[model samples]
Target: MATVRVQQADFDIGAEVAAVTAGRTDIGGTGCFIGTVRETADGRPITAMTLEHYPGMTERAMAAIAEQAEARWSLLGCTLIHRVGRLTPGANIVLVLAAAPHRQAALEATAFLIDWLKTRAPFWKKEHFADGAEAWVAARVEDDAAAARWGGGTAGRDRRTMAPGGSG
Candidate 1:
């Protein structure tokens, strides 16, 4: 079973990992990725960031992404948790865990999940600057390039061209 969550509360990484691999003797290695809110953007001081997503739609999209990852890798278990609402610098934003019988599979799955999540998830972000200005975050070319490596880019079947409400 895969673990997926979209909540505003913080998560315990150690506990999550333990839960996923509790009785998994076949799991030889576990790869984890923790995303955090950054303090700056484009050399500008950032105060906070707010993440918004369509409740039901967001979860379903993530599930599809997870399924794709499982199809590509020999994964024993997978976990993806993303925090919503306002977050300050250094706060935990997302956690991705992948378990497999080998380190390579685990590592690759973890990387693929994150890259796809960044590009395919239906999440919108607004960054608050220290100068009392805010702006909606735009998709970056680097992120698209990252997801493209895993065949989940804009051209893929699992691609998320526009966010919820049909906005880009």
Candidate 2:
């Protein structure tokens, strides 16, 4: 089963990796992706970022994405952790781990998870700029393109058009 968590607390990468690999000799490779709050976005200096999501809906979407990755690849295990609330630059925002019997499967699954999460998950972000201005983050075309590469039309949909309770 895949472990999916949506929390306000930070996650320990080492512990997460260990938990996925513990007593699992069949796992050969584990692809990991840790996303951190960057100091800048599109050349604008950022002080902090706040992420918000609907509790039940967000977890369900993440779990579904994880399941999709597992079904598409030969994954032995997977872990996805996304942080909410306020976050400063350099703070961890999300983590993804996909373990498989082969490196290719693990790597591809990791990529797919992150890409889909960026578009599919119903997470709203607000950026605090260095000048004390705050603005809601907009969805990027690049993210949609990345997710579309996985061959799903739903992945390319604009998140802004999604209904309040719908997953993009």
Candidate 3:
């Protein structure tokens, strides 16, 4: 099974992992990723990072991504939680966990889920520098490549890109 959530509060890694694998003995390996806000970028101070997302649409997209990952790999369980709103310098941004029968499947699926989530999900990030200036973060080429490895970007399949009364 796969679970997805978007919340403002921080998450507990150990609890999240335990919850996902509670009764699952089939999984022999588990993979996890925790993304945290960095305080410095090459000695420059970072004040804050604000994340923007569409409430209903973002959740649906994330659920779909989780489903895709579950189907693409031999996954026993998966959990994805991404925090929104204003976050301080060292807050946890997101967490991706995957459980599988083998380490390879667990690790790769975890990476794939996060990489695709970054590009496909409708989440935007803004960075505040120490000088008090803030700027919307530009999408990274590395993020593009990460999503591309799984096949393609979210363009045509994006819910927001769909017609007003139609699914994308």
Candidate 4:
């Protein structure tokens, strides 16, 4: 099973990793990725970003992502946590962990989870600039390409076209 959380609170990565691997001797490796709010986007200085999502829908989409990774790899455990509401520069926004008996599976599963989450998850973001202006974040073509490389069936679709809880 995997731990999935969508919240407005910050997470402690060390505590999360310890919790997942606690008493698990069979787990040989754990791959982790932490995404943070950056100070700039496309050269514009960002003061903050607000992440919003449909409550029930967001968790369902994330659960499907974890399930897919589990099906594709021999995972011992997995954890995904995404923060919503306003975030400042250097604040952690998301955390992903993939545990397996080998490094390869753990690493690949971590990539797959983040890729799919970026493109498929039901979340919207709006960035606030230092100039007192705000704009909704646009989907990058490169993100879609990264997710498509796995061939999980979400290839070539515009980010806005995704339906709630729908894969790919």
Q: Model 4, 81-139: lDDT tens per residue?
A: 99999999999999999999999999999999999999878889999999999999987
Where does model 2 exceed 4 Å of error?
155-168
Candidate 4 accuracy as lDDT: 0.91
lDDT ranking, best first: 2, 4, 1, 3
Model 2 lowest lDDT segment of ten: 154-163
Candidate 1 residue runs with Cα over 4 Å from true position: 152-168
Give per-residue CA lDDT, model 1, range 99-149, as digits (tens). 998999999999999998988788989999999999999888798788888
TM-score of each: 0.91, 0.92, 0.88, 0.92
| Model 3 C-alpha lDDT per residue in residues 19-134, reported as the tens digit of each score | 98888788899999999999875477889989999999989889988888888886899999999999998799999999999999999999998888888788999888899988
lDDT of 2 by residue, 105-133 (tens): 99999999999999888899999999999
lDDT (C-alpha, whole model) for all candidates: 0.89, 0.92, 0.86, 0.91
Give the residue spans of candidate 4 off by over 4 A: 155-168
RMSD of each: 3.2, 3.4, 4.5, 4.0
**Strongest candidate by lDDT:** 2
Worst 10 residues of 3 by lDDT: 153-162
Error of 2 at 16 (Å): 0.2
Please list all clashing residue pairs in model 3, or write none if there are none.
none
